[model samples]
Target: MLVRRFKKSLLVLSIAASATVAHAESFNRIASFGVIHNLPEGTEQSQETSPEIIAASEDGNTLVYSDSPFEALGFVDISDAKNPVAGGIVKLDGEPTSVAIGGKTVFTAVNTSKSYTQPSGYLMALGLQERDELVRCDLGGQPDSVAVSKDGRYVAVAIENERDEDLNDGEMPQLPAGWVTIVPVENGQLQCDKMTKVDMTGLAEIGATDPEPEFVDFNSRNEIVVTLQENNYLAIIDAASGKLVNHFSAGSVELQGIDTKKDKMLDFTDSQTRLREPDSVKWLDDNRFVIANEGDMNGGARGFTIFHKDGRMLFESGASFEHQVILAGHYPEKRSGKKGSEPEGVAIGQFDGETYIFILSERASVIGVYRDTGDAPEFVQLLPSGMAPESAVVIPQRNLLVSANEKDLIEDKGPRAHVMLYSLTDAPAAYPQIISTRTSEGTPIGWGALSGLTADPAKPGMLYAVNDSFYANQPTIFTIDANQTPAKITAATLVLRDGKTAKKLDLEGIAADGQGGFWLASEGKTSKEIPHAIHHVNSTGEIDRTIDFPKALLANEKKYGAEGITLIGDTLWIAIQRPWKDDPADQVKLLAYNLKTNSWGAVRYPLESAATGWVGLSEIVSHGDQVYIIERDNQLGESAVVKRLYSVSQDQLKPAAIGSDLPLVKKVLVHDFMPDLKSLNGYVQDKIEGFTVDAAGNGFAITDNDGVDDSSGETLFFSIGKM
Candidate 1:
C-alpha cells in the first residue's frame, strides 16, 4: 500500500505541468487586529471582548465592528492597509448587534432589551469623520442585523425579538414580535422621522405570528431581502413602500458523507435529512441573493443557498462546502453533533471585474471563496479565519477582505479575538500549507494533531508522522508526501496492540527502527495513570514490545515526561519535556534505553530559560553525528519567545548509568522558528512539536493543533530547507 500510494503521488507530479504566469491573483493575509487593543485606557486587559460584525469606510481607511461583550463599537484605522492600528471604541448604552457603512456615516443597531418578553432596540447613525452619534431612533424590538443601500439613500434593520433558550427549550412565539425597519437617508445623513415599520408577521410557516428576522441586505433596485433564521423562512420587501414583495420557505436539504457525532475522529459517512434554517442573507444582484444556512431551531444544512427574488431556488450547496473544509483539516469535530462547519455569515464583492462570494464557517473558522459563474459557483480556495468568525466585510476598492471573529479566550489565557485582514494581490495562496489526499475508497486521510515526525530511511521526501492523544480512540501513523505542494498525507495506519487499536497512549515522538519498524515516545501524567513508556512497533503498526521507565527514574518523575525519541545505532534516546524532580533548574534529562542490553542510562541537557514561562523540549532526531531537538516555551501569540531548533554533538552524549551523576551535553543553536511561524500573518502558535531531517538532508517541522479543541485548528508544516 505504501509503494502504491507513493507511485500514485509521483504520477500526479509527473503529469502536472508548470506554468509561469507573469500575474497570479490571490488573497494573502497581511495583518491581524486584536479586539482587546481597542478598549479604553482604563479598561482591564483581561476583560473579554469580540468583534461580531464589521464595516469599512467608503475610502477603505476606517473599520468599525460591533463588540457585544464590551457594549461598544470598536474601530481600526487601515490607512496603511498592510498595518492596522487601533482607533479606539465608542461606548454605547446597549449591546451593539451589527454595523454598516454609508458614505461618511456608520449605522449601528443596539439591543437594549431587558427581557425576551419585552424587547427594545435602537438604531444610531454616527458620523465617520467625527466619530460621534448623529441621530438615534427606537427600533421597537431587538435588532440582529443592519445594512445600507448602495445609493446611500436607505438603511434596513432586522428586528429579531429573540427568545431566551432557557425558556421552554427556546421554542418560538415569544412576543413583542420582530419586524423590519426602513429609514430614509440623504447624503449619508440620517432622517429618523421617515422611519417605517414593516410588519413581518404571518410570513413564516413556523411561528407565523412572531417572526424573528435574522439578517437584512439591499439590492441595486432598493429591494431588501431578510432571513427569518429560526423560522426557516426568507422574505423580500420593497423598501420604497415598506410592503412585502415575495416570501418562501428557505427549504430543506439532504446531506450525505457527513459525520454526525462527537467521536474524537473524522469519519464522513453519516447522513442528514431536511435541514434548512438560514442565518445571513446577501444580495448577489438585483434578482439573486445567497443565504447562509446556520440552523437556530431544528436545522443547520451546513452550507449556503442561492435564490431568485421571485422565490425561485437557483442552487443549494448542501454538503459541498463542508466537504472542502474537511479536506483542509479545519472541520471542528466537537461540533459534529450540532452543525458541521456551520455556515453563518456571508459577503459578496466584485473585484477585477469578477464577483466573489465569501462564506464564513463559524465552527471550522475558515472562509470558503467562490466565484460567481451565474450558475453553480466555482470553488476558488479556503482562507484561514480566526476562532468563531461571525461576519465579514469586503473593500473591493482597496482589494481587501476582513473577517470579524467573536471568540475571546481571556478566561483561558489563550489567543484573543482577532479581526484578520487579507489583501488580494498578484501572489500565490499561503494557507492550507499541509493537507491530506483522499484514499482509494474516496475518503479523506483524516489526520490532525501531528505531534512527531520522522523521514523514511530509503524514500526521499517521504515522512511518517504520529497523532497525539487528542484522538485517544484513534492512534494512527500517517505517510506524508512532502515533495508535493502543500505536502500531502497519503495514507494512515492505525497503531495496534494485541490485535486491538491502542488507547490512552499519547504518542508524541516517532523514529524508524533499522528493521522496518518504529520506536514511539509516550508522554505520561501519573494523575491519569498513563505511564511514560516506549513502544516498539513493526512496519504494519503492530506493537511488538513496550518498555517502561526505569524504577529509579520513575521515583523522580513529573507530569511533563517524554516528548520525543530517536535511534542512534542500538540505543533509543528520549527527550524529557521539562525539569523533573531531583534535576537541577533549567536542565532536563535525556534518557537512553539500550535495544540489546535492556539497560537504562541518562545525560542532562541545558534548557533555555524563559522570562514569562517554562521552556522545554518538544522533539528530537538523530542525523549525521548530531541530534537535532526542538525547544520551545509554552507561550502563545505575541508573548512567545523561545521556539528554536538546536543540535547537540553525539560525541558529547556521555551517558551515565541510572541513579548516577550524568554529564551535561553542550548544544548549538540551529535556527529560530519565529519568522517561519509568523509567515502566515497570524499570532504565533506555541506548539512546535515535530522536527526531522529527511534522507536528502532536508529539514522539516510541524506543530500540534490539540485536535482543534479550544483552538483555531491550524496545523503548520513547512520545510526549513537543508540542515
Candidate 2:
C-alpha cells in the first residue's frame, strides 16, 4: 500500500509540473497596419512615409503616430483590434516630432526650427472627439519628446536644440542650448501661459554647454526624467517647481563577446568600450528608471541600463540583449561596425500586477520583453517587429502592445513603414520559428540565410540546412532538431576545402548521398567569379570532390544557375533556377549528372506563367519514385502569387545529352504555400528557399532572412505534415 501511494504521488507531481510549464504567459503578433494606407486619397501611395512615435487614446481603441517625412500625424482605428482601419492623417504646419494623448485630447510637439542655432518649435493640442486643433503654444526651442503626468496635472516637453551633423562633424556646443518645458493641464485643457522653462546646462561631462534633451517621461510623483542622448546625460526635474532635482552621466560600459565588424560573418569574440548615449528613457517606478542606449556620434552600449532616481546604478544589460538577437537569427551583420542591434526605444507598463519593459532594436527590427524585478530585470522573450521600430506603446488594460516602425523602402520596393500590434495571452508565441542554442563555450551557433534543407535518413526529426553567400567567410551546415515546438538548431559544421573554410560558395541546395557524404549545388554568378559546380562533401564537411558542367551547358549559362539537387541511385538531379539562354521560353532545365557514367544530360520542366513576376524552381527532393520541387515568384507581400510545390514521376525524367534536343517533363501541383506564408499575419516573405521531408515523411519548409540586411529577419520554419 505504501509503495502504491508513493508512485501515485510521483505521477501527480509530474503532471502538475507539466501543467505549470504549459501555462506561462506569452505575447503573439496579431495584426499589422501599414502607414501608407493612412495617406489621403489624392496622395501617391508610393510616397515615403514613417510612423516614428506613437500613443494611444484613453480607451485604447485609437492610436496616433508621428510621421516626420510627410509632416503629418496619422491615426488608426483599432476598435476591431485584429483588423485595424485607417483613421486618416492630419497635416501639420511643421514636422511633428512626438505625440501623446491625455484622456481624449491629443498633444504633439512640432519642430519648426529654421536652423540649429535659431531653434523654434511649438506645443499644440487637438481634440480627438472634435477632430480639430484646440490650442498652440510657442515652446522656447525645438521639441523632440512629449509626456503627460500620471495624475494628468501637467505635461513635459524636451526641447532639443539639435545640432547639424554636417557642421563640424556634429561635435556639440553649437549654441542655443536646450532645456525642459513644463506646462499645467486642467481637465484636458493646457494652460500654455503658465509654462516654465528649466535650464539644464553645466551638467554633462561632454557638451555641457549645450544640453540636447532627446526624450522625456513622467513618473507617478509628477517628476520628469529626460535623456540627453548626444550629451550622454540623464536629468530629473520636479514638475511643480520646474527645478532640476538630480543629474548624472549616462556612463560607459566595457563590452565583451560582441560583433564589431561588417566583414560578412557573425563572430562575437571582439570587444569595445561604448558609452550609454541613451535615446529613450522611461520610469519603471518612482525610484528606478530605464534607458535605451542608442549612441549617436561616439557611443552606443548596444543594450539598456536601469538606474535609481538618486543616481545609483541598478543593472546593465551589457551586450546581453544583442546576444539574444543573435540567437533569434535577427542579428544585422551589416551594422556590426556601427552600434550593434541599436536599442533605440523603450516602454514600461504593468500587466497582471507585474511591470514589464519593452526594448526596441532599430537595426535588428526586434523587441526584447523583460519583467521588472527591482534589481536586475528578468528577460522574458523576444518579439519580431517591422523594420526599424522607433517607438512602442502598451495598453495593459486591453493586453495590447503596438510598435511604430520608421523605415520606408519605397525605392528598394520592399516592405513599407508599418505599425505592428501584439497581444499578451495564453497562446503560444508565433515568433522565433527557429533558434540556436549556445555552444559549450557559451557562444551561439550563429546562423541565418538558410537556403536548403535535407533530412537525415535514419533520424526521425533530424535535418541538415546550409547557408548561402551572405556569410561568405563562414560557410556552414546546421543540424536541426525538428521535434521541438520551434525547431532548434543543435549543431553546426563549417564547409571546408583543403582543411580551410570555403570562400565564395553560394550553396543553394543539399542532397544526402548514399554514402556518409552529401551533394551540394552552388548557384554561381559570373560577375562575382563564383562557379556553378556540384560538390560532394563528407559528413565532416570536407570537400571530397567536385563536378563542373560541360562546355555545351556552360556556354549558355546565366547568373541564375543550379538551385536544387537530389540523388536517385547513381544519378544526381539538379534543378536550374530559371530559363537559361539555351532553354525554351518559360522553361527550365532539370540537369542530370550520372556518377557511374561520368556524363551530363538534361530535361526541361514547364514553368508557371506569372501575371506580375517570373516564377522559377528553388529546390528538388526525391522520395520513392517521385520528385518534389519548390516553385516561387520573386514578388513579396500581397503581390506574391506562385509559391508552390510540384511533383514529377521518376519514370518521366529520362534526360537527353546536353547538346541535343531535351524532352519536357510533366508536373502536377502538389501544394500551394500561400496559406502557410499568411498564417502569422505578417507580410509574405520573398524567399521560400528551403523544403524537405523528414524520415517520418512529414514535410517542412523555411524562408531566408538575408542575414537581417534591410529585412525583418523573421525565419518561418514549420511543418506541413505528411506530404
Q: Rate the local accuracy (lDDT) of all candidates.
A: 0.87, 0.87
Predicted structure with the largest lDDT when compared to the true one: 2
Tens digits of per-residue lDDT for model 2 on 1-723? 000000011111000101012327888888998889999998998889989999999899999999988999999999988999999999999999999999888999998888778889899999986769999989968898999887889989999888888889888888899999998998888999999899999999899999988999998898899999889989999999999899988888778888999998889989998888999999998989999998987999999988888887778788888888888889999889989899999998898998999999998999998877766677778898998889999999999999998988888888789999999998887778888877887776688999998988888788889999999899888999999877888898999999999976999999887566789999988789898899999989999898987888989988898888989888999999999998887999999999999999989999999888688999999887899999999888778999999999999989999979999999999998999988887778888989888889989999989898878888999988897
TM-score of each: 0.95, 0.95
Worst 10 residues of 1 by lDDT: 1-10
Cα lDDT for residue 175, model 2? 89
How far residue 472's Cα lies from its native spot in candidate 1, in Å, is 0.7
* Clash number for candidate 2: 0
* Candidate 2 lDDT trough over 10 residues, lowest sum: 1-10
